[model samples]
Target: MVKFRYFPDMKDNNIRNFCIIAHIDHGKSTLADRLLEYTGTLQAFQMKEQILDDMDLERERGITIKSHPIQILYKADHKTTYTLNLIDTPGHVDFSYEVSRSLAACEGALLLVDASQGVEAQTVSNTYLALENDLAIIPVINKVDLPGAQVESVKHQLVDLTGCEEDDIILTSAKTGKGIPELLQAIITRIPPPERDFNKAARALIFDSVFDNYRGAIPYVRVFEGRIEPGQKMKSFATRHVYEITEVGKFLFKKIPTQELKAGDVGYIVAQIKNIRDLKVGDTITTLENEAKSPLKGYKEMKPMVFSGLYPVNSDDYEELRQSIEKLQLNDASLRYEPETSEALGFGFRCGFLGLLHLEIVQERLEREFDQNLITTIPNVEYHVTDRQGNLFIVDTPSKMPDMGDIEMIEEPYVKAEIITPPEFIGNLMTLTQEKRATYVNTHYLDPSKVQLIYEIPLSEIIYDFYDKLKTVSRGYASLDYEFIGYKPSKLVKMDILINNEPVDALSLIIHQDQAYYQGRRLVQKLRSLIPRHLFEVPIQAAIGNKVIARENVKALRKNVTAKCYGGDITRKRKLLEKQKEGKKRMKQVGRVQVPQEAFLAVLQLGDEK
Candidate 1:
C-alpha cells in the first residue's frame, strides 16, 4: 500500500499558503485582486476592487474589516499545477487580532510595503507577529507604477527592517498587473509547503468559523497531521465533545466541496456544531477515538479593551437589537456583551470591543446589515477598581464604579504604543502624545529618514481622538500600533453629567483627576451646542460626586408675552411680564428635556475640544 501526504498529484505540485500584511491604503487588497485576476481564479467581469472585502462598510470605507481566506490554482510552465491558499488580512490596528489568527494558519506571509509610504507602524508590528509565528516572509514592494513611487527608498527600508537581500524584494504594481507573475513564481519557489504527518492522530487548527442556519457552525481549518471528511467522528480538542462531520470543503471564493481535507490542505469542516460557542476559533479538531492531547499553540482569548452602551433608537426595538447582537456575536468571537440598563437611556446592552474602530465597524454593521437602529454611547475602556478593605472589581462603565469614599484606588489599562513616522514629525507626535499623558519609552530609526517612537500610554487616551490628533500633528506621515501591557494605578474618578439637576448616568465617564476638569468642560460645551433651546433655562453641569467642575446652559427661547400689551399702561406690561415669569417657573418644574439623538453622539465629539 502507498500513502500520500495530501494527494498523489499534490506531491508533484505542492500547496503554498500565505497572506499579505500592510498598513491601511498600502494596497494589500489591490494586490490580492491582481493575484486573483492573474491566476484566473475569477473571470474579469466577475471581479471588482477589493473583492475579498465582502462587507458593504468595508467596500464603502475602502478598508478590509475581516480576514478572507480563499484557494487558487496556478499552472506553471504549462505543466506543474500549484495550489495557492491566500488569506487576505485587515490592515487596521483594531483588527490585529484577526490578522494574528489568519497568520497562525498560514506557513508564509508577503510583507507588503508601499513604495511611496515606506515602513509604517502596522507594517512593522505585523512583521513581528509573522516572525513570532515563524512564517516565511517574502518582502514585496507594491504600487511601483504610481507617479510618486520611490521604489528604491522603500526597498532600502525593507532590507534594513527585514534584513533580506535587495534583490529578494519583488517590485509589483497591483493596479497595472505588473510583476505579478514573478510574485506568484516567488511564492512557489521561495515559500515552502506545509509539513505533513500522515500516521499521527488527526489534528486540525480552527482559525475561523461562521454560523449556518441549516448546517450549524462550520469551521475554517488548516490540517496539521491528519485528514478530515464527512462521516468522521471528531471532537473539539478544547471542549472534548464529539460530533459527526457532514461535509468538508475548500474556499474558491465559495465553498467547493472536496472529498476530504488532508494534511497540508486548508479547508472547512461541518461537524454540525449546533452551539456556536462550542466552535472556538483557536480550538483544535481531531478524531474522537484517537484525539490529540495538546491544543494548538498561538491561540489566545481576546479581551475587549473598549466598552460602550448600545441602545435602540426606538424603545420597542430593544428585543430586535438583542437578537441582532446575539447573531453578530456568533460571527465575532471577541465581542462581549451583557444586559445593562440606564435610568435615562432605558434598556440597552453594554458591549465591549477591541478598539474604537472595532466599535465603529460593529455599530455600522448592525445598523446596515441587521437593519437595527442603535445609538452607541461614547467608547470607554475597562478599569480595575480596588475598594477599601482589599476588594477588587472591574468597572467597564462609569455606573459600575463604587462610591469614591469606599474606593482605595483605581487602575486604568495601559498599552505600549509603537509609532513610526518621519523624523521631522517626531517632535510634533511627542507633543500630541504628551497631551494624552504618554510616558516616553525610547526611539529607534528604521533608516535615517524614518523614526520609530515607543511610549506607554493609557488605553483610554488612544480610544478617543489620539489617532486623529496623531495624524493631524504628523500631517498623515505617522502610523500607530499598540498592545495592552497591563493596568496601572491612576488618580481616576467617575464624572457625571447633570441635565437640569438630574444625573444622566449614560453620559458619565471615568477619567484621571488631572483631566477631569478639562474633559468635563469639553463635555458640557459639546452638549450645550447639541441641545436645542428649551422653554426654560436647562443647566448642563459636569460634576464629580458633589463638586461641579463645569457648567453650560441651554438658554430659554424668550417668548414675547408682553408684546400683546403694545399700547397698554406700564403697570399692565409689568403685570403681564410677572405672569409670564410665574408660568415659566411652573413649566420648568414639570417639564423633561428631550435630548436629541445628536446630543448622545456628542459624547464622541468631546475629544475634539481643541
Candidate 2:
C-alpha cells in the first residue's frame, strides 16, 4: 500500500484549530453555523441549520454525533490570512470519547454554556475535561437574547466553577449573531498558535476519523509540530504501525485535498488504511525517523460501558446487520463488538457502547443505513466477578453468568451524581434519588432559588433509563452530571428467565436485590407485551437466584393465522408467512418471540401507564 503526506510552506503562527464544547442543546451547533456565516465560508443560501451535523439522525436529534472539522479564512488586520479549523463536537456524556479527541486536537476550546440553564452537568464535566487537557478556555455565555437568559449570573457561575475571571466571559447569542464578531476576536487573541518544531520529525494527533467510500478511512489530525507531504512514510507512536499517506486534505467546509500541510494546521489524511481500528483517537502520528521521545501519554482506548445483543428481524438479514455494524464502527470507534452466537437468537453481535445514547445512536444508524429491522435485547452493564479461587471474569452478557457456587464476590462501578434543581422540587428529588440506591452527599444553594444536590449512586442504577426517569420526575428542571467512581461491593444477583424450564439467555439481567421487585415486575410486564401470543401459554418470569419475584403470561395467540388459504389466496399464506416472519423477527426469539426494543423500553413506562 502507498502513502502520501502534505508539507505546506506557510508559517504556522497565523493558524488556529479549536473546537466548540457545550452541553446538549446549548447551541454549539448554532454557534458553529454562525461562525461559518460570519467568516463567509458559507453563503446565506448554502447554509442549512446545523449543517456541520450532517447526519440525518444528528440533525433531527439536534445533537452532534461525531466531531466534524471545517477550515475557514478569517480576515482580520487587513489580511485574509488565518486558517481557523473549527471542530464541532457532541455535547452529551455518551460521546465524551469524541469530546476528548476534539480537545486533544486543539490548543483552545470555546466553552459554550446556556445563559438560562447556567453551568449544567455536562457543561461542568466537559469544561473540566478541557481544562485537564491544558487547553486555553474561552467561556462564552450563549442565549443572551432569550427572555430567561441570565448572562451576568452565568458569568458568575463560570468564574466560581472554572476559576476563570468573570470579565473573561463573553455574552453572545448565536441565533442573532450578537457578539459573534467579538467572539471571533477572542478566538484570535486568546487561543495561542500551535507550537511546533518544523526541523524535528513530524508528529500529529489523530483526534477524529470518518469513513469515505472514495477514500477508505480518513483520520483527522492536528499537526502539532513538524510537517508532512504526500508520499511520506509515517507511523503511529503508540500502535507502532507504519503507513504511507495516500492523500492529504484540508477541511475547507468540505474535505479538500492539499499537496502539503504544515505544523499547527488541522486536516485529514487518507493513507493505506482501511480499518479505523488501526488509527485510534488520541494516538500520535509522526514521521518514521523522528518519533516523539515517547508516544503522547494517556492514549488508552475507550472501554465500552454498556453491552447488548443486536439481531435482525429477518434471520437472513444477519449478514447485512453485520455489514452495517462494520460500516458504523468505521466512524464510531467507541462502539465495540464481536460475533456472538446465541442458541435462541442465532448469529448476532455482543455490542458494546459508551452509554445508553451511544447504543441508541448505533441501533438507529444500523436500521437507517442497512434498511434492516433489528431485535435488540435490553442493555446491561459489565460486572466483575471473582470466585473463592481468585479467578476473575468480566461478565458482559447475562448468558455468561457464572455458576452460583463459583461466585465469591461481585463488584460494580459507582458514580458521583450532581443534580441541579429548583428549590421547590428538592423534596421530591431527594425521595427519587434515595429510591435509586443513592446516598446523599451534600447540597449547596446556587442562589436563593436553585440548589445543587450531590449523591453517590451505583453506576448500574443510572445506566438503565435513569436519566430519562430523572428528567421526567424533575419536570426537565434538573441537570445531572456523573463520573465513574471505581467499584464497590454490593448485593447483586442475576435475575434469570426460564421458558418451559429452559433458561432464556436474552431475558436475564444483573440487578440489585432491593430493586428486583420493581425491576423484575417491570421486565415481566415488558416481556408479557413483547412475547407474541404463541401456541400454549408462555410465562414471563423474573427470578433472582432461583427465586421468582414476578410472573406474567402471554396467552396462546388465537386468530394469529387464517384457518384456510383460499383460492388466489395462496399468495396470502406466503404473505402471512412473510408478515409472520417480519413480526416474529421484531420479536426476539428467547425460547419464543421477544417483542422488540420498543417493548423492552416501554416496560419502564409502567408508572405512566398507571
Candidate 3:
C-alpha cells in the first residue's frame, strides 16, 4: 500500500475530484446539470440544458466535443460541506484525447451508462481508459425515466463489466432530477482526494484550456502538490515559458474569481499569456524558483490521423480563411494545418484531423462560425512511402506520391476495429468486412445475445464509408471503435481523375488494386452526371498512370439555328448552318471547361452517398 503526505497549505478531506465519462447521447451533460442544480451551483431558473457545453456547434449536435471543468459546493445531510470538482468530458472516440486528459485530472470517474443502450463501443473504450488511469469508477445507470430503460439487463451488464456489487450501481434520471442528492453524497464519500506531499515542490497539471480574446489563454488545472494564487510565478514543463500569475479562479458555470487554489482543487489560471500554444494540455506546472526535476509522464501530443484540403469558394478570401483557421487552432490544438496550393483549386491549407467527425466539426465551425463558404477535398490517411534508395517519407495527399520508378513500396495505415452488436447481425457484418479486405480477428460473446467482433482493416477502406455500410448491414445496432495498428506494405495505386484529357490533381486518390476498376468506373459515372455540358463533348476518365480504367462523356450543348431565310435558296440556309458549326468548333478549341466546386464535392461522396 502507498501513503500520501498532504500539502501543508491545504487539507484534502473536504475535497472530491471526479469526472463523468459516458457514450454519446448517454446523459453526461444532463447529469452534470442536475449535479450543479442539486449543489445550488446554479439555480434551476438560471440553468440551461448542457450548460457546460458552451460551443454552439456542440449544443446543435447534442454532443459534447470538449470537456469543461466546474466546481460545486455540496452540503450533505450530515451537515458536512464538501467541495466537488467535476469535469465533464465528450463521449465520441474522436475526442478520446480530451476524455483521457479529463481522467488524468480526477481521482474518480462516474462510469455512466444508458439504461436502454446499455454498454456501447465508447462506453467500453472509456471504461478501459479510466481503469488504465487507476481511477475509482462508480457505475451509474442514467435515463431510467425512458420507457425503454431495460434497467435489469443494463444493470447486469454493468455489474459483469465492472465486477462490482449490484447494490453499488446507482440508477438516476437526469432529466427529472431523481437520485441527484444520493449521487452527490456518493461522490463525496466514495471518491478519494488528490494526493500531495507537503515537503515537495509545488506542481499543478494543466488538463484543459480555452482561448479568450479579453483574457487570453485560460487553463484549467488540477493542483497536485502545491498552491497557486494571483501573484505567483510559474513555469510550464513542456513549453518552459515562465509567467507571473495575473488571476486564479474556479469555474462555476462561469469563471468565479478565487483567492487561491491549493492542492486537491481544480480551477482556472490566467497568466497573462496570450499565446494558447504555450498552454499545452498534459503539461506540468512548477514554481520558477524551484523548478521540478521532470514533467509528469504520459504527455504525448495528439497527432492527426486524417488529412484534407480546405479552400475558399472564392480565391480572394484565401487570406481571410487562413486567419480564421489560425484563430480556431488557438483553441483546438488537435487541428493541424499549413499552406498548400492546388492546380485545380488554387490556394488552400492542408488540414489534419483526428477522424471524420473531427474533420466535419472543423469544417462546420469554419463555415458557421467564420461565415465563409469553403470547399473541402476528400479526406485521406497518411501513407508511408519507401523509395528504392531506402528513404522513407510520409505522403498526406495522393497527388504527392513519389513516382512508381523511384518507389520501393507503399505502406498504408491499418486499424484494429472493435465492433459490438447483436449476434444475429454477425453473419452480415462478416460478409461486409470480407468485401473491405478486413482480416478477421477473434470474436467473443459478450452475453447470450451480444457479440464483440474484432478485425484488422485498412484505414483507407474504412475512412470513406465503412461505418455507414456496417450500420446498414447490422441494422443500426452495431457500434465501432478503432485504434491505429501501424502500417503494412500494400499494393496501392494512385488513381487520378482526368477531365477533357487534363488530370485534376485535387481529384487524385490512393486506392487498393482490387477495387480500383469498380471504384474508377463509379467515379467517372458520377462525374459525368455532375459536370455540366461544355461547348465541346468533354471526356471524364479515371486513370491509373497511362491506363484509363473508366471513361464517360458529357455531351456538348446543342446550338439551334433561328436565322431568317426568305423562302429563296436552301443553299443560303446551308451556308448559315455551316458558319454556326465552324464558330462552335473554334469556340470549343479556345474555351476551357470550368468544373464547378460542387462537382468536386459530388465526386468525393460518389461511393459513400446514394
**Top model by TM-score, which number?**
1
The per-prediction tally of clashing pairs is: 0, 16, 0
How does residue 326 of candidate 2 score in lDDT? Answer: 83
Q: Write the per-residue lDDT of candidate 1 for residues 1-610, one digit (tens) a residue.
A: 2122233357723899999999898999999999999999999898999999988888888898877889988988878889999988888888787788788888899999989899999999999999999999999999898899888888889988889999999999999999999999999998889987766788898877788888888888889886786778988866778899878888889887777887888988877787677877677889865577787786676678899999998989999999999989877777889988988788999998988888888888898889998888878998988888999999888898899989998999999999999999888888888889999999998888799999999998888888898889888888899988999999999999999899988889888899999889988999998888889999999999899999998999889988777695799988988988998899898989988888777767876657
Q: Tens-digit lDDT track for model 2 on 95-156? A: 77668878988889999999988887788788888988899999999999999998777877
Instruction: List all candidate RMSDs to the true structure.
Output: 3.0, 7.5, 4.1
Better of 2 and 3 by TM-score: 3
TM-score of 3: 0.94
TM-score of 1: 0.94
Greater-TM-score candidate between 1 and 3: 1
Ranking by TM-score: 1, 3, 2
- Give the per-residue lDDT digits (tens) of candidate 3, residues 1-610: 2122222333558788899998888999999998988788888689898889989988999999888888787778757677788999888887787788789899999999989888877888888889989999999999999998888888878877788898999999999988887788788778887775544677888888888888888888988876776677889988888999888877767777777777777888888888888887788898775457887776777788999999998999999999999999888877899999998999999999999999999999999889989999999999999999999989999878988668899999999988989989999999989988999998977666568789999998887888898889888889998888899999998999999889998888898888899888888888888888976788899998889999999998876664577688798889888888898788776778898887777656865654
Model 2: residue 531 alpha-carbon error in angstroms: 5.0
